[model samples]
Every structure is written in structure tokens, then in C-alpha cells.
Target: MINLDGALYPWRFRLVIAVLLGMVGVIAWRIVDLHVFDHDFLKAHGDARSVRHIPIPAHRGLITDRNGEPLAVSTPVITLWGNPKELMRQRQQWPALAAALGQDAEVLSRRLQQNAGREFLYLARGLTPEQGDAVLAHKIPGVYSLEEFRRFYPAGEVTAHMVGFTDIDDQGREGVELAFEQWLAGVPGQREVLKDRRGRLIKDVGVARNAKPGRELALSIDLRLQYLAHRELRNALVENKAKAGSLVILDVQTGEVLAMVNHPTYNPNNKRNLQPQAMRNRALIDVFEPGSTVKPISMLAALQSGRWQPTDTVEVYPHSLRIGRFTIRDVSRGGGPVLDLAGILIRSSNVGISKIAFDIGGESIYRVMQQVGLGQDTGLGFPGEQVGNLPNHRKWPQAETATLSYGYGLSVTAMQLVHAYATIANNGRMVPLSLARVDQPANSTQVVPEEVAKTVQGMLQQVVEAPGGAHRAQVPGYHVAGKSGTARKTSAGSKGYQQNAYRSLFAGFGPASAPRLAAVVVIDEPGGEGYYGGLVSAPVFSKVMAGALRLMNIAPDNLPPPLPEQQQAGALPGNGGRG
Candidate 1:
């Protein structure tokens, strides 16, 4: 007590007291500001850590055939996602999580490290509902799932080229899917959701938008006919060892494509081993010389120009006609000295047709072909429909004109050839083809006189009815009129033609008295015993047409009577002439 008074000064004591009071005042102001003035900002920060804006996926549209049979549909699936930072924090759980996901733990760890800065990552996609539930039941931290729709094609490879397919993110990639994507993919919605620390959704706060489901699409394809065409084309491809093939069937009266199929197809559902070549729609995309198939059209042009008549006869002696430096020969050697229009088509005489083309000039032939939809689109609006090449005839030489008359020096698609044949079946009226059903019958323009069409039809009938015609294309209960074609394939990237490669084609209409269906079959590079259109492609036409006619319940007009025993005992005419 005696030293305490000397140890302290009055000014120094007052200064120390003032410093303590200042410190206390500052602490009080800071406490009030944190608890009241900035309270809303602090609360918002806390909420941001747990709240999320989640997506609500909308269901895609259903795709159906003309009869309302489902071709493509969507099914609900789950996709598992995770927060990389949180997922990596649980190192012990990595092995278990990887096991559930069918992944290796070391790979999973590496993936997490690669995505360290990412808040969300896909753990797995396209999981079934049951599988998703099993994964969630494990209560793994940072793992969550979202509901999504996956496309399912019921027809598989049967309708692969027509229906096409979607991608993992539900976007259309090919075929009709890619063509009508906007009309099929719907709008997605959003919602505010509260998430737990492990990224699991706890509760939905409120809706931000409502999802609008896509509208259903109905195609003009008849599933039954599609199946029939697909089966026949596949069988022919396998039997003939063909590199590829396509078949198109059209309703003659309405110009609607009843069926379209291509070979070298793939299952759109399983895309693990899908190749780009397998996805091509050969019927509309591939172009080939029509070969002798154009003879009917050329004959029609001659008939239209009034320069030729059905009863007109042309001498085909030596079975070959010389044009400049080129020679056009008939497939039947030493058979025709003089042939009427009927016999010319029945024999598929190159010389007879070339002589006619020389008389009418190339402009008339080109006009007739153009009117029949050659060198033009089919108006199907398919993704890759090609408008084939048709050269101008103004500068044509005799040889070029001759070749053009018999379907060379020009190209046409399978669909275009089918359209031309359908025009003939529709009594010379050109109707626009459709891939979707029309409420009313399409308008038709008269491309050829009715009399000319009738005459051509009768002449074509002789092709199947005559003793040495396309007998393989004959339907037992009906009269079939068709032309067979065998054109050597032009070598790609070269000027000359391939020695062995050929495109076997058949184009025809059925029920001569009252035609209804027009079909075309194309077998590319058949490598088997036969490669001619009559030998390799006509049989396909006969079988498919028989099924199609019976399916549609068309009346039989030319059912053959039972042959006499003596005639039946003789060998049937071989399908070896012309084509």
C-alpha cells in the first residue's frame, strides 16, 4: 500500500481507461450490425448452399404407323448424378459405390479427381426404375437420380430406316426422328428444390414452369406391308449374297407409299455396334441406271408422240442395231425379225427400243421421263431423298440418245422408278407421293393419254403372260406386268463401268385389268448364282406382291385356269431372258 501511490500517474491511468472504453464500444456496434443490419444477406448465403433449381423433363411424342400401331414410344428411366467434392470426401465408400455402378474403384477415383471443380457429374444414365431404386436404397452420400424419358422402337430393325432413332439426350439423330424433331421434342420445366448436404433432394419449394408434352405423330407407313417388304428384302439379300437392297411399295390409286424397306439395317435400340453404312435409306438416297426398266416409259413416249403405235412393227434382225460407233443388242439373239410393241416389251429388245428412240429424238424421251418424276424429288420430305441426274437432251449424239432410251447416261432413285410405274398403274396420271396419310385423295395431272396408258398396260401384260417373258414375276391368281433390268454398276470415282458389279432391278404394277399396286425391287451387287433382275429380283416381286394383294383384298382379275396335263408336264419357261 505504501508503494502503490508512486507506481501510478493520474494522466496515464485516465488514458488506459479511455482505451478500454473505446474497444468496448466498437465490439457492441459490430454485434448489432451482424445480428440485425446484415441478417437477410447472411440468411440468403445459407439458403444458397442447400437450395437448387432442378429441371423437370417433358415426355417425348409417340410415333405410330398409319393404323395407329406404335412404332416408336418413350419409357421413363433414371439418371444418377453426384457432387464430385462430396463424393470424393467419402473415400471408404468409393469401392462400394463403384461396385454398384459397375465401375472400378480406381477409375472412379480418377474420374472424381478430374471433375473436382464440377458441382454435378453423371454417375450413370439410362437405368431402369428398379435399378435406380436399388442404388438410392444404399443411401450413398452425394449421389442422386433424375427421371428422364428414353426412346423405344417396337419394330426394331424392321422399321429402323423409317422410324430412325434418338440420342442419349433424347434428340433425334436419323430418319423420321430427325426430320420431325421440333414437333416431337417437348419443352422442359423447372422447380425450386431444397437439397440436403449430401445433394439429395429434400423437398420442392415451388414450380417455376410447367412441362408441355410433345404431340403424337402418325406416319403413312403401313406396319403390315412394311414388315412384309422388310422380310422379303432381307431374305433376298441373304439368299443372293447381295451387298445391299431396297424395296418400295406404293398405292397406285392414292400415290401413298405403303411400305419402304432397306437391307444392311441395324437395330436402332442397341447402338453399341451400329455403323454409318447400315443406317442409309437406300430406296430414296441411292441412284442407279434404270436399265431396261425405262423401256416402258420410252414406249409410252413413242406412243404419246404419235410417231409409234402399239401395232407398229420394227425389224430386229441380227438382234443388234448399230448407232455411230456403238452397238445396241437385244438379250434374245436371233429371235426377232419384226416385233410389235407387245413383243418388244416382252422380249426387252434393246435394238427395237433404240430404233424407236432414234425416230422420236431425245427431247421427247426426256420430256416423258421428266413428266413421270425422273430427275425430280418424290416429295416424301425424307431426310436424304436424292433428286437423281437427268442430262439435257439438246446436245445428244445418236449413241447417247440410244443409251438414254434404254435407261443409261441418266440416273433415277428407287422411289422415282416406283413413282413412274405407279403413274402407269394410275392410268397415266402423275400423283405426288406422300409419307403421311392424306385426308383426301391427291390431285393427279394427266401425264399421258388414257389410251396410251391402256395400250402400254396391255403390252406390259404380255411381258408376264407371254411364253418367254418375265414369267418369274407372274402372280398365280392375277395378271402381273413388269420389266426386268440388269445394269452394270459404274465404278465409283472412275469413268468406266465395273466388270462384275451389277444392279438388278424390277419395276411393275399388278392386276392388269384394274391395277392397284406399284412396286420396285433393287438388289445391289448380288454375288450368288444369278445377278439378272429376272433371276434375282423378279421372284422377290412376285412373293411380296402376292402377300400385299391378298392383304389388301384386291379382286383377282386374271386368275389362270388350270393348265392341261400335257402343257403342265412341260418345263416352265426359265427366267433367263433379257435381264
Candidate 2:
């Protein structure tokens, strides 16, 4: 029955066959276009949707002290980011996301809306690994985390001013961080990565650029000494109720800054409440009149002029010297009516020192001070270092000269004072100061004659060892040489000085026989019962020097003899009168 071959096929059947064949041809054409002719273009288009070029962050360098202890380091952290458009689409989940991110919902919403057009917006800059993990565990869409670094100061405020700190973006903002930003910041790399629709990383396609890590930096600061200085200075500040203070320790031979500390320092790691004043490196920035500490320098000038000998005597009867409407009085009441050269320094007699300065002339004293690196930067290359104010010798009147001899009419930084004392310790050669480790000893220029330095150092030893000298400055077993200074704080605009405010200063070196360390301690505006440098600052020197000498293994030169009956009964030497 089906044998009717050649019977005409239905029109519907033919139409159906033609339609099927056309569909096959179109499918074949599409396959060829996608897999052969336009493969690269189509693949690129697909990649553009799912693949991303992300930056690979490089780590910053480490800052270490001279002994290889880390002062500043970069620690890995996570930063949360979001695609504003994608995040907005999941607005209902915002409360949960904001809770996980520790942000207010309204604040998060406003921030997202403000940056709605941005493909990348930071939700939180620095986050702990646990925090980032907690956010990711929520599985909120469009939220992403990136690896980053946060600066950590291991020494905290102990070395804060010296090592400084970085900003959230890893840029150095202060201290050594700002000074060596170029060397500390590294280059970032780029890599192409494939991501899923939910913005989860799938696979790394390829690396475009390799990241370069920063180089390491080694500073000259000895952490042990730095800690010691910080502890002592902080204690002194608390005890004296001083407004602020600074302490600097220098290597007498090498000119390396072993320790530099400032009071009222802030923690660099947590700078949320950091004040501008707390961040200042007061040792190098703040300047003040050096007061009676400069007596030795004036004596040095007098001796160098061939006009005064170690045995020379001066009569400061009534303890006052009148010069051109200015009266210089001795702090000593009864014992300073007459004194020898060593007695003058031991007693800290302002009138006696003034008499010698008048004999030597102002130019000689100014010349000696200038030669000792006063009124100049200490060559530390620190940011905002002040050169201080030393008036020209030609501008000095007779009264000004008398004041200059007693360390008034001029200003000096704590660092400059340390440098000057270090020069004396180095036997008159002024070495360039450094904050970084140096391979070789720095070159020095002779400021004072070697004999003059030795003689002055000997006289300074008397200032610490004499019966009425700075007995507080004496280390238990080490011979110490230093001078104490107490100067009235000058008012901001007026020529007159503040009545009660004073700057207590002590400068000296330890192991006096062969000086190894020279240090300076300045307590600003001490509001305690005793404001004299000998009473306030000298004790700090004694403690710090004792520790430093022991740490350095320097042999002590003096051993105290057994105390007499009176001394054993709690009566210490140099406790009778003001220095």
C-alpha cells in the first residue's frame, strides 16, 4: 500500500525540512565565528567581564637599631573594599554587613551612596586578619579584602621620635620614616586574575609585573641605651613635674648618637590622639639658654687666652658684680666671696665666672663657643633641627658679655650641648654627629687645644667631686665630670624672664679618666620643690651614667672610701648649699 513511489510530498513537510536546514546553517556559522574567525575578540570580551588586573602589594623595609633589633616594621594586614554598585544591589543585607565591619548602618549607606559610581571603594583601610575573616564569613556579595601592611613600632614611645611612623597608606609622615621614604617604600606589581560572578577570586591568569620589596635600614641608636635614657628621663619628668624634657647620649669617640629621648612622647603605633607638640624631637628642636653650664666654656676661653691659670683666684665679695645696669649674683651665699678657678665651677658661682669673663673679654668667650659648634646644627640631618641663636661677638655690650659668660644672651639646643660636651670628652676635636651607623670614625676639627680640653675636663671633675660640688652627679664607682645649669625661662615676647619657671640642665661625661660617653639632660620648667640643675638634673645623669658605664663594660676609675660617722648618718656630700 505504501508502494506509491513518486507520490507528491505534502507542502508542509517540505517547508519543515527547509526550515531545519536553515537553522543548521546558522548554527554552523556561529560556531565558526566563535571558535575560529573571531575567537580572540570573543575570548577577550568574556575575560573583560570575569578577569581583573589587581595590584600585588610590596612590603616596606624594616628599621633596626645598631644591634639588629627591630625598631620599626611592617606587619601584614587586610583592607576591606567594595564595589558600590554591587553592594547597593544587596541593600537589605547592609545592616549585617555594617555590623560585621563595625560601622554604623547609616554611615555605611551614606558612604556607599557617595561613591556609588566607583568600582572600588574602601570600606575600612586597616583591619585585623580576624576582622577581615569575620566579614568574609558573612558571605555578603561585592565585599572584598586586600592584603596590605601596617607600620608597627616595636619600641613604641621609647624610640618613637627617632624612628617615626607611617600613614595608613604606608607613607612615612615623621622622623626617620619621612626622611627615608624613598628607600622604604617599594614598587607594587600587577597580575591578571579570574573572578567569579560573586567577585570571588578563581585563578591567577598571569603576572604582569613583579613587585620589588624595599631595602632594610640600620640606625645608630643602641636600643638598650635608648630604653635607659627614656626610662630615666620619664621618671625625672614625673618627679620634677617638669613641663617637658630631653636627654641625649653620644659616643665621645665616634660621634654616634647612642640614645636620644624626649618627654611627653606619643606612641607612634596608635596615633589617634597624637598632638603636634608630643611628636616634636625636643632634643634637636627646642632651644634654651644653657645658663651656668657654659661656665666651663668661659673658663676654657679664659685659660686659652693665657691670662688665667688653674690656680688663678677671684674675689667675688658680697657675691655680686655690677655691669651696665645688670647685676650678676652668685648662687652661693657665704663660700663664694673668694674662690680659685676650680672652686668657682664647683660652687657654680655666677659672679666669680663673670669676673673671669670680664678679664678675658667677650670676643674670647664668643670665639670659644663658636668653635664648640654652638649656634649651629649638629649635622644630624634631622628634620626641623634648629641652629639656635648666638649673637655676633660684635653686638655684645659689657652687660651682655657678663650674661653670655653665664650662658644667657644666647640659646642652644640639647643636642648642641651634648655635642659640645662630647668634644671636650674627645679632647677638643669636634666630630660630626650621626643618626645612622657609620663604618669609620667621622673626621673632626680641633676646636680647642688638647691640653685645654684635658685641663677643663679636670676642672669639671672637681665640680662633681668637691665637697659642695654636684655630688648628685657622681656615679658610685665611676669618676664623673659635669657642670650644672639653672636658667630662668625667658618670656615669649617680653625681654624680662619668667619669675618661677626655670630650665634645669646637666651635661657631663662618664669614666672621666678616659671618657667614653657624654650626655646632656635638660628639664624644662620644673615645678617641683627643687629647681636647681644640680638637685634635679644631676641625679638623672648619675643614674644613666652608672647604667651606661656598666652596659659598655667601661672600667670604673674611682672607688668610694668608707663613709665617716657624719656621712654614715644620712648626710651626703654636696647637700649643704645650692650649686
Candidate 3:
């Protein structure tokens, strides 16, 4: 401490070291904070400049037949969308964009001006991938292409009535498309994507939310049978020069609608200039008085009432049945004075059916009809299905009851008629009708006595077997039991019957010994050589059934009997009449 100007104190040395070390420590701490503590925050800010959330398209569910044949498919497509605000700033590119989209430049300008306030607007929808790629190649600002799917029907017009069609935006419009819209429309998702300064996608970062594809729907239809039905129905329509027609085939065991088709149908893919009425699924929605087709059900009622036996004979006055102010007449003549129930149905005598109906009372017949699904909705929930009309039988007078017995007062869709027949074919047990493939048979209800049903079914077999009574409906190698009806259509206002307006119908099942399939065919306004159900509709039924039974490998129940007296024994087994 003696020479203060020349000597340094220990405190001063310690202070100098402290200042240097503190400076280094502060620098090291700042480096650690920047590299570790604040790393995530700074990185997020850096990404915000180029990161984006993009949409991931969800495809619609596939529609297939029971055999996994694709009926409706979702095809990959691209949609062009844009941010109007951003697009408006690049007005110079409008002409190029319009030319790419095949639109007028002037029109595009007006549309853009009207939509400048909107953040998003669609330029084109359902464009081909090539078209979208071409548009994107131009690299127009604010214009973006989004991947999407369009519903395409492979079966086209053949399965149009069942599959239906969708709108341009992929929204369901009619048929199964509309009925199961909720189940078929999937949820779209989002994903994080990296983009360049020019708004071009660079990389997929990660899925923000995974897309959920729609569940696949397998319908109960068999495409093979559908084609068969369509071909046969179309032939009938063209051959008979009929206005329209419908045909339905149902599996008796499972109550499955194997095939259903309608005429004057529109292609699902091409709906331009499509008539609204052409889209109607006539088989399910169109209602007609079943005509003579219900005659068997009437006999079923009579048997159930214990008032008449199928073998019991009724005194007949041909074309001579008068009920109150109305006179019920049969179109046939030259019959025996006394006719049994079998003969009555064979000739389709309105008088005989009416007498049986009146004796048993309309209430009895109504009970049977009601149990057989008349005026009831099939649980299939098909779009545009009509419940049809079934008035209270107790309110019917004698004339009304008689007409009801012969299938006039009540109405039935082709689907309902087939259901009733299928029930009887299933041994009087009613099962739920299904349009979807079912793993198990639905619960059955005894709508009519099994014995009554069997007896009536046998009587129908005899009628079909009888000469000149739906003989045309016989399927080669199969024993068919069915009824034919030629009814004069009522006037539009229900005022009275119209002339030259007939609905020819045939409804029956094959392999009568052991029923497996039931079908119904209705030909409207047949303007050909013959218009009777047996002539017009029966031939179509026979062709379709023959092909269907053979296709299904159903065993031949009616092997042609050896010719009586060996007359024309040379005739083919399937072509020769019953011996």
C-alpha cells in the first residue's frame, strides 16, 4: 500500500475478471434460449408464411349388386374453384381462364364482378382430370383445382329406376340415390400442406383430419336377372307396340325383389331433355286394379270363409249377372250351364266370381286381402312407392263387392301384387319385402290359412293348365300357376270405363310343385295383333321365366308328357302342349 500510483489492489483485479466472465455467460445464456426455449415459437412463425390447410376429398360409397357387380361407382374427377377476391386482382388472365373453361370472356367477367364479394366461387364442376390439369398448367393466380368424385352408373338406363341419378354437385336427386343419401354421402377431410410463394403445392405435411369414405351398399338385385328382365320387357313393349310396361320378379323364400324394370326409362348419365314421368318407377309407384289377377285371392277368401269348396258347382247364366243398377257381364260365352269353381276361374267369369264374393260377403274377402299387404307399404322404403287404395269392404254394395272380387274396387302396385303372390307361393306366410341383400329370412306371418292358400294355389294350377286359359304363361320345363286379366282402364276422372284402353296383366309363379319365384307383368295399351293378358303379357312372361329358370338351374317340374295318341311326338319337349 506504500506507492499507490504504481500498485493494483486485489479488489480491482477481481472486478475485472468478474466483468469479462459475466459478459461471456450472458452471451451463452442467450444462445441457449434462442436454440432451445423459443425454438417452437419461432419455427411456427416461419412456417405460417407457406403452410396451408387443404381439403381431402371423400369418395361416395360404391353401389353393387348382391353378387358384387358394380351398379354405381364413384369416379375421380376435378373441380375448379377460386378465391374471387384474389382472382379479381388478376383481371388480365380472365380471358385465358375463360378460354380454358370454354366460356365467353364477357360472361366470365360479369360473373366475376357479381361474385367479387365472395371469398370462394366455383368455376367448373366434374371436369375431367385432363381439363383441370390444363387449367392448372396456366398457373393463374387464385385459381385452384380440387379433387372430387362423380357418381357414375355402369348399368345406365337398364338399372336407372332402381339406382337413380344424382345432381351435378353429386347430391342425390331420385331413386336409391335419394333414399339412402345419408348413408352414401361421406365426410370430407382436411390436411396440412406446404406451398411455394406462387401458391403451388410443395409437400403434404400431415393429415389434419382423415377422410371417412362412405359405406358400400349391396342391393338385393341380381344383374343377370335384371338384364334378362329388361331385354324381355323391351321386346314385349316393341313387339306389342305398347305404350309402356313393367315386370317384377321376387324370390319366394326370402321375399327379395330379384329384378324390377320399367319402360320409357331415362339414362342416369344423360338426363338432358328427360321427361319427369319417364323417371317414375312404374313397378313400385303405378297402381292399377289387379283385374283378374286377384281372382285367386277371391277364391282364397271363399275357401277361408267355409262357405264354398273349390269343387262345389255354381249354376251359371252366361253373361247374366245383374247387381242393382249395374249389370256385371263376362266377355266369354259358350259355357256349360253349371260350372265348378275351377271352371269359373278358368273362364274368368265375372258372374261366378261375383256370386262367390257376395255369398261370403265383402268383409271376408277384405280380411284376406288386407292380410296379404293390400294398401300397405312394403318396408323396403323405396322412393315414390305408392300404398295404393283399399276401401272398406263393409261399405261396398253388391255391385262394388262383385267388382272387388274380380279386382276392380281395390288398387295394387306391381310390387304389392307380387308380394301377395309370393306370400302364397311361400305357403301363406307373409315376409318382409327387401331391396337389400338379407342374410336371414325375415319373420313370417300367417296372413291366410296354409290349407286355404294351398287349395287356391292348386285351383290356379288347374286354370293355367286348362285349355285357352293363360296357357301361354306356361314356362318350358316348369309348371306355372298364374292368372290373366284384361281390364278396361277407368277414365281419368273415374267417370267410367274408357274404350280401347286396356291393361293386360299376367301374375304367376314357377315350379308350382315347389314354388321358388313369383313374377308379375303388366302391358299397357297393347296395340298389336292381340291385347289379352294371355296373348300379350303371357308370352313375355314365358320367355323371361324360361330363361330365368334355366339360368338359375331350376329343375324341370313339367317334363312334357308323352303325346296323347303320339300326335306330333316329333314336337320339342318344351314346345308341345300339356298332354
- Each prediction's RMSD over C-alphas, in Å, is 8.4, 9.7, 7.9
TM-scores of the candidates in the order shown: 0.87, 0.86, 0.86
Estimate every model's Cα lDDT from 0 to 1.
0.89, 0.91, 0.87
Candidate 3 per-residue C-alpha lDDT over 1-579 given as tens digits, one digit per residue, 9 for 90 to 100: 376632457777778889999999999988898789978777787689889998788887999988999999999999999888889899999999999999999999999999999878999989989999999999988898889899999999899999898888777888888888999888899999998775678998999998998889898888999999999999999999999999999999898888999998988888778998899999999998889989888888999889898779877785678766878888775457777888888888888888998899888888888899877888878887999998884476897788889999788899999999998888899989988888898888999899988887887787688875778888777788888888778889768888898999998888899988899999989999988898899888888888888877889988967677556665658655565
> Which residues of candidate 1, in runs, are more than 4 Å off?
1-51, 195-202, 560-579
Weakest lDDT window of 10 consecutive positions for candidate 3: 1-10
Mark the regions of model 3 whose C-alpha exceeds 4 Å error after superposition: 1-52, 193-204, 393-395, 561-579
Off by over 4 Å in 2: 1-52, 194-203, 334-336, 393-395, 560-579
The sequence of per-residue lDDT tens digits that candidate 2 reaches over residues 1-579 is: 575333465776778888999999999999999899989988999998898989989989999999999998888899999999898899999999999988899999999999998889988978989989999999888898899999999999999999988889999888888888898898999999998876778998899899898889999889999999999999999999999999999999899999999989999988899899999999988989999999999988998999999998999788987876767788776564678999888888888888888787899999999999889867777888899998876555788788899999999999999999999988999999988887799789999999999999999998999898999999998899999999999999988898899999999998899999999999999988999999999999999999999988888788767788876765766676566
Cα lDDT for residue 548, model 3? 80
Q: Between 1 and 2, whose lDDT is larger?
A: 2
lDDT of 1 at 7: 58
TM-score of 2: 0.86
